[model samples]
Target: MKRSLRRALWAGAVVAVTVAAVPVTTAFGAGTVTTTFTKAQDWGTGHETRVTVTNGSSATVTTWRIEFDLPSGTTISSAWDADVTSSGNHYVAVKKSWAGGLAPGASFSWGYNGSGAYKAPLNCTINGAACGGGTTPPTTTPPTTTPPTTTPPTTPPPTTPPPTTPPPNTGGKKVVGYFAEWGVYARNYHVKNIQTSGSAAKLTHILYAFGNTTGGRCSIGDSYADYEKAYTAADSVDGVADTWDQPLRGSFNQLRKLKQLNPHLKVIWSFGGWTWSGGFTQAAQNPAAFAESCYNLVEDPRWSDVFDGIDVDWEYPNACGLSCDTSGPNAFKNVISALRSKFGSNALVTAAITADGSNGGKIDATDYAGAIGNLNWLMPMTYDYFGAFNAQGPTAPHSPLTSYTGIPQQGFNSDAAIQKLKSKGVPASKLLLGIGFYGRGWTGVTQAAPGGSATGAAPGTYEAGIEDYKVLKNTCPATGTIAGTAYAKCGSNWWSYDTPSTINGKMTYANNQGLGGAFFWELSGDTSNGELIGAIKGGLG
Candidate 1:
């Protein structure tokens, strides 16, 4: 009789185990990928927390499925990266594209919009154990601190809050440029060249791009390596190791070197690009929490010494970029609000926004003028007029400041964009005119001078029909100006841009219009001696 009962107990245990496995379906089916979640601290206002995911095991992770179960009382207000679906208290993010199927040892990340407290997951399972994590290690909670029984009166006298320093004078012109650290390899330029060439000295603010926001991770690419080398070169010039690197080193260290050389340059980290901007829509839900997380990462005493400001280079806030963000008009303002509250007035916050001037482009999707009210400046990328995208007969003007007859694309150029912004209530002093140092042209066109028919757009190294400004200056000289902007003609093709002569005209316009100043696409695209910056300085005079 005892033996019979033992068999029955064994059978019951088997049944219980089968029931537990019911909730676990094949973990990762064919072509499916998985992502796990890790929580981090929220620094302050205008910040959000970071979540990292690692792809384990051998198979390719074509697409990822991430499910975040928020703790009680905490919630998501916005999200960036993947499309999200929430039920009860659980938030799930899914990838739209396979993204080349992450290889073994590859990892991708995403961020969350959360509020209140943060905690680690109690029950977590990612694509089988081989793909990683089924059980979390037990964590020890620290004992609560006891307050002193009888506190003495605090020392009465102390220092007053320091006076706010006046923002550095931009000489009535906001100095701006895209500092491509990677140019060290392909274009061969250094940050010091920016300094000695008067590029750094005549400037007001600098944008150090692309730390990558798509994966919700802060990583340094090869370009970061080049930036490091540039800093080393700058230090050699000063003959002293930068005093700023004591706290943290890296790109920020290089920025410190630039500052030491000029004492006037302000560096702002620009997050996201055409490729990485999709995550921002997700991050917008919990705008406050997301801003707090960004604050911690940017000012994390670890690298705080290197940065004086933060800039959002989100391609579009409400509409679409390389990826679409349908989060609505308030998404951008909400995010910027969180940042301003957390960082206060001390840290500079700004943005680069859409320049599409058509009747129904990105500008129509959101209220940009309102969002930039608190910004130090607004940069409109006013180039990329015509490329191989339109392979038709009527070759249009690539960089015309204003619309003209025989132009290929309708209602696209700098003038329409500027007028739109001004009409929308954006103060002229807050707007910085964007100038491209390069030219866009078509190669197969047989016509001569400014207007002609083309077979296709000129081919480019990275994108179709684009060339650096420095190259264009020598290849094409100015033929005329439409409205304080320059255009030129090459044999069988037409190009538009601002030379030193035309840059002076742009600066004059900025001054007359009470506009902030002029900014260019990049620093390396200028002449070896930085003639563009010189023109800006000279023109502002």
Candidate 2:
């Protein structure tokens, strides 16, 4: 996702409140606190809850605690953003160390997952004072009770099937590249560039991104650029011009020609992205329907031969991305399982997921390991861990392969995420290490090393704080290395990006770790001569 879009969504608050007899308020020393309980997501057997505490008084609140009671048979399974403890039916929540202080009018929220029926908490209290709210009314009992009876079954139960194991690595490494659909507009990067740059011969798969996930169904992102636009004979790969009306004439036809030139290449249509992932929540509601829509669109008779399979790019499922999702941990597994069932074992199925490896981070928010069996591979987005998003000093590398002494954040590096996923039961062979062909840096830096202070984001040709390696490599050549990555400080302007030398080191790490292979964000970032792509092919070999 773009940093600007992420900031816009984060600024917009998503709050839901339940009305009570009186507004919940509690008096403390020199201040007052009001807490609101909202249900984020609710299914039959499980649900998610969010509690927001606001400082309503003039004084700042340095610390806080909330206590409440749950209905009978309800139990908390997991929680985040706060420390929670339960005893019998009573639960107590304390603010996390990082979220301890709140200025007046500011609010902090924490969420949890629970089992059994959803119910608003009773006897809510903040600090030691009562929150002026009445308890929920008790359920009414039936006048008469009947004994339960059981009937014997005439047939025996069916046996359970054994779990399926993922296929072995077999020593074949993959080199996957993503081709953006909209790149043909302003970027003017045609499919022929792959052949011209020598990337066509090295690539094993080309993921055409991205098909849209709209209205809870798979849809074409850009019809004109995908298969409608006409190409001149000089621009066409096969040197054939399209008539005024042709069934397929756009990038689809060009990619088919490219595949013929490189017989080992496979093309997969990737659906959903950071901006389009909002529809995955609705898709999870009916996985079978979503799968059917995807199959039809990917295998459309118009250009069915263009795509070999499908790739789902639901960013940070059941967690925060461009939007927040409370679809529960198993939502990703259910969706992928449905796709596998619909597409069958022979068809390729894969996904691009979050690389957050911190405690209770995004990796812990979804069951990626459980869904690995249904996937051909999983791409952990190891880049974009940090960027101009912070917008201040403490400049750090956005895609470090390993950690350094003064790394800005913990568990944000690629190695941390890869190891975490492997520890969680995902086979190393099914996980592909992600590499970014771009660089993220800041300007106005005094120090050249990794923890330098910066004034703001560095300007780029298109967007600030980000630029393709093809542009950055010559503009600001790397001067030093840290934590197994490259950095450059050219006249007070600091930049951090992966160089050919650093890419070789990362590839060696992947091989030693028994990883399947490597994949980059997009092919357009490489130089016209395919310098970066050549390095990747050479290193992987």
Candidate 3:
């Protein structure tokens, strides 16, 4: 029965979107620009405006463009950029390109000369959101003539302790940074930034891969392949170090070098994913052997030092994975217990569990709350509900951090998942919110804005009709927030994703929930300057 259920879930996730008239939006994995306009200011004379755009999305905004409809009676005259244009009242500001992209947390400013008194535009759009009304700067006052008469009192001096060594900066958050795995394949350039941003100093763990599984015989899937590519690529970098390096090539080896660069970073091997999870059933049949195999593989003398922990990513145990196993409700807990007994707490033991919270859905398949007490942290693979996969549908939400109107997949969103886990007995601090680094959508969509669907699945490298979060922030920003997540439409396509704006909100939610921290799917999927990670840090702050 479990095996059958797992197979059904896998079948559901693997199927392509049915053909439809509208274009389907991509999944929430890539195409999220972290940079957003936070606060905007206006100065007179073509009014110099100050806009605060922060990087919180998965990727950086290399060249940001701020466009808004200007008020009538005002025309852009002399401009600092000098290349901006005025379409009636509409004004568009483009980066010089030479300034390069703004790094995460980094801000950029430009001013324009225009006619008429400076007044905020009636309609304002910053990073695609309706910013409401413009703010007015406070007035400054001139000096007054009143004189002071009171004198200061004298006091005794105090002695200080003998000069002792000072402690390090030690930031408030322990796990401030985590590297997602997808970056190993496509955007391999960021491994260095992870090292440079002092992220290594603050980072405690790294989670690789978006969605994949323990294929036949405990073998991994495409995510492993991507990891191999990234591992090999790191070898090309002269003097680069990794924490999980063995003489043989792999992310483990590359991570070894990364650790050498920053000894604090911990690399853990995660198995099982949203796809290809059927193998867990087979492994569960011989949990002891499977656990032994994992121990040997992770602790192999060559790269043993690099691997500080092991994470079981079985989508769910006993219940089902991408495929199912009939080992009974206790199968998942047994497998995890076996792993824990074998590896012990000296090495980290963690897992990513199912977020579905329905009465008899995936949540009931296994004992999540019961299992979490023994593990260090529980990561919930949030996001990816309404995409091309459900083409020709009442568009459901994939990763709604919270609940909202028109959410087809009501209880399955992130918030419900976390709440359900907590209600089941999992401690809030033991939980980590999982944020998608990409967007999910279907092409051939017909609706111009938010709620719409595609006639069928659109083309994609791994999954049909889904795209990375980095790509969609610019292509299809959410018209408004749904639940805690956001959804938007571009042309006929419909998309669900988190932007720098929404990520900030998610971070706040995580802090409010007392979650251990947040984790994204893969690292390479984010922008070059490390925007998403920056948001994670700032949000924690």
Candidate 4:
């Protein structure tokens, strides 16, 4: 589990909604166009707002421009889905080139993050008509002629950019990304980033990682992160501050709001990852008891609506992972069978299995094919095949698509795993190729090639030997491609990981093989603008 380095579970950290505004409209020569502004979220310091355009006329509207005025203290910092530029407190927004024209009854939306508290825009107009379609409603006007009797603070709270969503489409393949529960702490990544970075728009489903499997039963990984930490209005998904009296707050509440924003997206609670897989041994002892506990927890009224299904990420079933499992090959199949019996047909039941495809390896240690009838999909962890785990020697790519000459291991690559599983009766469509969003590195390397020797693991921001693609994309870009993976020889530090180009190649292979879509270990690895995920979505198409 190359991504398992992130299993550093620590305590959780603590971390908001706005009013809906009415829309106005105007009629152009081609058709009638309408624009509406909504205050999506409001923290004391910053806020997020959205603008929606709709075509209400009989004919197709080719284009539109929106202009609006903000109060002296409010300003637009950043926006997405549309091109927006501002001068002083006045702003102009034009449709993006890719958005094209709107047909009859069509609606389009874009948004921005702003400075200061939430304040509705004024003098808003679409084309030449008042937004929403009628006369502008009257409102209290600021006294411009005379300065305010009581001057407010000269400096406003620091402004932050808000979420900007594009039109959602996945080209029919499932794009799943993991959102670590502990990320809110040191990583400072929240549910809102998923929407703002545009990953939310590209993703078909989100795996809320590692709900604890301690005691052979499902449990909360972090109380604060799971459903207790209060989010200020500014940090919230919908811009509504969390209340003490509310039934749920933390990421679960934020995920609820995220679902509202992106109705096409589904969230799954994933139990047991690398650090927690030991519990599966006990869980396998009585699969029925374990399945019942998971069902009760996933369906709890407190956040029953937050999840669409369950995903089991047992590191290795009936085999060795972080710790060894001697529960027998039938253990995995039995557990999945019980889960399907409990979760029923509507709920999605999925699993992430080992990628050790070497003959007589972990792939053969469990009855994976026997559990397929109960699973919606199976994710073969394709990365982590080779890394700095063996501190000294033979630098190799962590994720290789094919077996290359002088490869350190046979049947350790992605193609080998996929082929091995297929040979065992698993359907190509039921298997999802796993991509790692990070890279593994080693220091004290003599040669840049795969056969070089190394002294130790390279230093990283969070852990040794592992770093996010976001940092590696700049710090140590790819210098060579071998075994269908990218490697960088920056100084004595040699690192190997997948790039967008490499990911595109893998996606092409996925399509050619008539396999299911691709999934990554996590989300925060991508660029802030979602460059890597964009490549995955584009490649899948």
Candidate 5:
């Protein structure tokens, strides 16, 4: 999923929409506390915001406060993770009552809704220190130790950490992962992490997501991010700096280098996500033309060697996603047929479709079976069946593998969708099960069991309702298992996600069902050591 689409996919319509923020650091006291303000969502007249506080100093901080002034015509409305008091356009926020002290290198974040378009907070101060880290007298002492010397590379580095374990076994199955283009932004996750985390050694294919479909043609999403930004010598994948006039740079160059390191990996360009699905209806109108345009874009001479083929992730054909699609049942099959015809049998032709298994749901609205002959593999997004999108929660696992007595919705689990597609004649060998590397959670919950009540979305470093599995593993470890998944209740926050054990169980089920393989939503969500993907490989073996 792309940035906006992932936000919307798990958080729902109103919660979708996010842009990267340039972090602002505060200087003055012993512990330098930095604050970053990000526009989580913007809707013309109003926007939601998140403020992150990072402690870079040696000492631990028991408490903190932030003060900022909004420009005229803008004001604060609602807030989370902090208590706010406003005087005209100026607002002061104190740490939330339930929050604990911040340790060195630790971070805390709070958010609010404000009027007018998203704007940077002016005259910002964190714990009485200038947010921009000006040369001010010591109000408090900060940073007892010298700052770390190495800065993370903007581009992938040439070095690869030795594998901590033996090479992963996929058992002739594919371990596909999606790498979001925008992850190089605020996420600070570059292709280098894939190598260092040992994921590159495990992955059989990497799907580069969201090459835009605009004007009914395949287009680049961000030119600078895709192939324009230059990489320094230290950040270059081959340890050679990007030239001023290189034909390719940015992520394209980095991926090309990554492919060199892992010859077994195939990269596929995936277009159309929740935010961009609206364009599919138009592309579906002329499947042959659409396929031709995509063919040209994928085989562009500049990066022709970087990709194997294409994967169309149109949200839905005759069904609904972020927006409803009225394209008849033939639209999807027609598009796939045209793509296979153009790309030929040598290239990989795949797709990602809805896992809705209800009778007459999205699965029943399209001609998925007809496209089988033309496609190499089809992925059923088995996750996101339920989330904090509905604020009041009956607290359920988001990616339940099987049905339970109190499942909120019938036929919403992973097994139901897989079985439904199999019944429709979609060969198990051509169907890959989808797993989300993140978790969906809610706050203000009173119970610990699956059935519980929640007031709203749980606070997250990036978005409200969702968080990466890497953070969730350490912050809120799972307490119990249910429906072949895991759930945890830490303090008042409740989260549901698949643990390594659960993923192992799921993978066993996948192998037993004679399925093709298992693919995750993306790679950035896994631990720095690639724990989850390791489980996937181990279980598949």
Candidate 6:
């Protein structure tokens, strides 16, 4: 699940129109510019907008600015592609240094989130000249009908028929789990636990939770924990002693030994998690260079044997996560294409993507289906759809397989995401369902069922409002079930999470949906006896 601090921005249907171009001759320069305002999405109180500035002049544009006025009550929340500032009802957007100097006939766009009803901006101007040739007529009609009930087709139909049979479920079905690099710290979860807990025997692959994206290249998140720290035989995977002069002695070496015990296990180094995702924006600028850097780092001679492939866990592409990204829709496809080109066809390349199934949501923000050809599989982060992020009342299940009445947001469940992706031409066999090993809850709740009021985040060992299943199982025993998940109310606190039984149901849904497999967030959350992992393996079988 996503742990970044960002407000839940619901997706809505997009309505795009090409406003007529207007020629503006100014003392600064003479150019023909057109401003296209696209109502990208609107979820009642909040909406998203995309504005494109086109240069029709013969000369190149070095610097540009746009000015507009919002409706009486509307206000901008967040923006991308340009530096935006507002005063009273006026908003000014200036091109970012990176986006400056547009060649003739070129175009650049920026998007933003706004409050209140959607309204066309007034007095639109580009380079101090009238926009779209004239002022945009005021829009009184409400933003296009509520977000569409279904996701409109984004990709064209394939020229050839899709395979009639599902991809071979090699070795039954894939059971993937993440191994966090930082877990060896206060969490004390070492690679050796995967073996002692019996998870290795049942797992198909292990995703080493993160390599970093820094300076537009693949870098180490924690050098000491990743490969420098020494582990004794007691804590090592192969009961091997680490010599003082050894070049590699940390988790990377331990993973290498784990593969010896479980040959079927494949390890993939994932990059750009919530904390490290900011660099992806820079990477998208030059995907080939980024891919080359990743190839070199993953196959770094020292521990090349440890990693089977690369997994890009970009919190999101062409959308907002920890930081806003304005790389446009093809950014993700371009990056994956470069990775596939550099890594070659034999290496396993995958990605963990957003599960925002809402109309015009993150799913529409990128060309995911177009990139699937280069990927071994795509994991939709179906959990973390809802959490204590909205600290107020109206609590709901965080990872629901299906939607139910009074759901906090529409199209936020796992099923909705899966259906949307399939509709967008992503083969069911290439998609993996995501499961969370922890639970989200609230404190001071009076009612037992969801939608109850809460004082604030529930107390947790590491962070407020979140607790691992290992602790949640005993701390807050299951009291009932809702939306294909488990919930419990112990004292004034109310918690909602998934259990073995719920995972069984989710796995059954995955089979029915013809999904490739199921993958969970991390390994440390399960009990020492591998209770949850057992359920996953048993259910997949």
- C-alpha RMSD of each candidate structure in angstroms: 22.4, 19.5, 21.7, 19.2, 26.5, 15.6
Which stretches of candidate 2 lie above 4 Å from their native place?
A: 1-171
| Deviation from truth (RMSD, Å), model 6 | 15.6
lDDT of each: 0.55, 0.72, 0.53, 0.75, 0.74, 0.74
Better of 1 and 4 by TM-score: 4
Model 5: per-residue Cα lDDT over 117-195, one tens digit each: 8777777777786654332324344444322212112111101101111112345567889999888889977777888
**Model 5 misplaced stretches (Cα beyond 4 Å):** 1-170
Instruction: Give the clashing pairs for model 2.
Output: none
Location of the lowest summed lDDT over 10 successive residues in candidate 6: 155-164
lDDT for model 2: 0.72
Number of clashing pairs, model 5?
10
Per-residue alpha-carbon lDDT of candidate 2 for residues 1-541, written as tens digits (9 for 90 to 100): 3322222110011111211112122212123565655554444465555556656666788888888888787887666546789899999998754343777666555556577656777777778666544432112211121101110011000010001212221135677889988878877888988888888887878999888888779998889989998988877777788788787888998998898887778898998888888889999999999999999998889878888889998876888877888999999999998898787645678888888877778888999877765677788887887777677768787788877788877887888888777566564556688888888888889888878888888888778888889999999999889867888888867788888889898888776555667888789989988877677777777
What TM-scores do the predictions have?
Answer: 0.64, 0.70, 0.62, 0.70, 0.70, 0.71
The 10 consecutive residues of candidate 5 with the worst lDDT sum are 155-164
Reference-based lDDT, residue 500, model 6: 97
- Cα displacement (Å) at residue 99, model 6: 35
Q: What's the true lDDT of residue 103 in model 1?
A: 65
Top candidate, metric TM-score: 6
Candidate 4 off by > 4 Å: 6-169
Per-residue lDDT of model 6, residues 478-516, tens digit only? 899988988999998888889999999998877665566
lDDT of 1 at 350: 77
True lDDT of residue 212, candidate 2: 88
Ranking by lDDT: 4, 6, 5, 2, 1, 3
Off by over 4 Å in 6: 1-171
Better of 2 and 3 by TM-score: 2
Summarize candidate 4's per-residue lDDT along 1-541 as a digit string, tens digits.
3354532110000112222222222212122455555554555566556566656676777788888888878887656546788888988988755455776666665666577886777767777665433233223222221111221112110111111121134444678899999889888889999999999988988999978888899888889999999999999988899999999999999999999999989899999998888888999999999999999999999999999889999978877778888999999989988887788655778898888778678888888876764666788888888778789958998888888887787777888888777556465556778898899899999798887999999999888999999999999999999877899999999999999999999988876654557889788888898888888888888
